[model samples]
Target: MSEQLAEERASARPIPGQVGGRAVMLIPRRDPGTDESMLPPDYQRIIAAVRQAAGPVMAREVGEGVGVDVSVKAKLEPLRGKLVRLVDRGWLQKLPDGRFTTRL
Candidate 1:
């Protein structure tokens, strides 16, 4: 067998009870199903926070409140990107005033 094929096969396994499931795992697309998709756990938490706020909240507020350092120049900035994705995915709405709120 080709080394590449052997590696792929070795990395795949049947789920505990999903023998009928797809044999090859699929990586999610970067921008999939924005209109009718479920938010990831972290995004859900951010939205919950926005919902609890007095009004729409800034990305940094939500990011820091959710435990992300968010130091403008952080070596690896993830929270802000997640927030942007949440907006892009329709899980959150960005106001003209530059804040985020749960989509109606």
Candidate 2:
């Protein structure tokens, strides 16, 4: 791993029960810090669902767990987008095989 990745991994502290009764690893705020005010309600729900699963979950599985009607492609699309955004934001890690897990 690169030095930055190594440092990030090392610096992350485990936050128990931060999500869905599971332990989550969180990297301390680097500067401006976490802005919960910016997250939409749906996004928060998705995060909670991801935490409950507590592993590298596929998009469809996350949507199903979150109670989204997985039978409809349209409904799944937005949820998938939200999951991607969460991964981009460093709150999640996308595995090489396209699975997702909490960054911690």
Candidate 3:
């Protein structure tokens, strides 16, 4: 092989997140709605529900408060994920009773 061609082939490196020779792009997870604000857009309903509640509220109530009558899991799953994110960010907390409340 030509020296230049050999060098070019040697310098070529595989991209990350690839498995089994498939191109899988891996991105760090982040809340898209939290770009410029403390609260993410996706969790606005959740926050509203918690804020409107008399006290710390259950996840079910928050899911219902999102206007979801059925498929509560659909609502709760993303809400739960966002809540975890918020908690990690120090803006919310999960109570011992599996409820949520805002820190600020």
Q: If the candidates were sorted by their TM-score against the true structure, best first, what order would they fall in?
A: 2, 1, 3
Please estimate how well model 3 matches the true structure, expressed as its whole-model Cα lDDT.
0.61
Whole-structure CA lDDT of model 1: 0.61
- The best candidate by lDDT is 2
Cα deviation of 62 in candidate 1 (Å)?
0.3
Clashing pairs in 2: none
Report the C-alpha lDDT of model 2 over 1-104, residue by residue, as the tens digit: 67777666555543434778777544233223443333556666777777788677888888888899999999988888777777776666788987777765
**Candidates' lDDT values, in order?**
0.61, 0.69, 0.61
Candidate 2 versus the native: TM-score?
0.61
Tens-digit lDDT string for candidate 3 (19-101): 79987533223332222123334455667777788888776777777775536567567667766665676556788887888
Q: Which stretches of candidate 1 lie over 4 Å from their true place?
A: 1-37, 75-77
Candidate 2: regions farther than 4 A off: 1-38
Q: Which has the higher TM-score value, candidate number 2 or candidate number 3? A: 2
**RMSD to the native, candidate 3?**
12.5
Point to the candidate with the largest TM-score.
2
RMSD of each: 12.5, 11.4, 12.5
Candidate 1: tens digits of C-alpha lDDT, residues 6-80? 565545432323336846322222232232223445656777778888888887778667776667647225666
Candidate 2 global CA lDDT score: 0.69
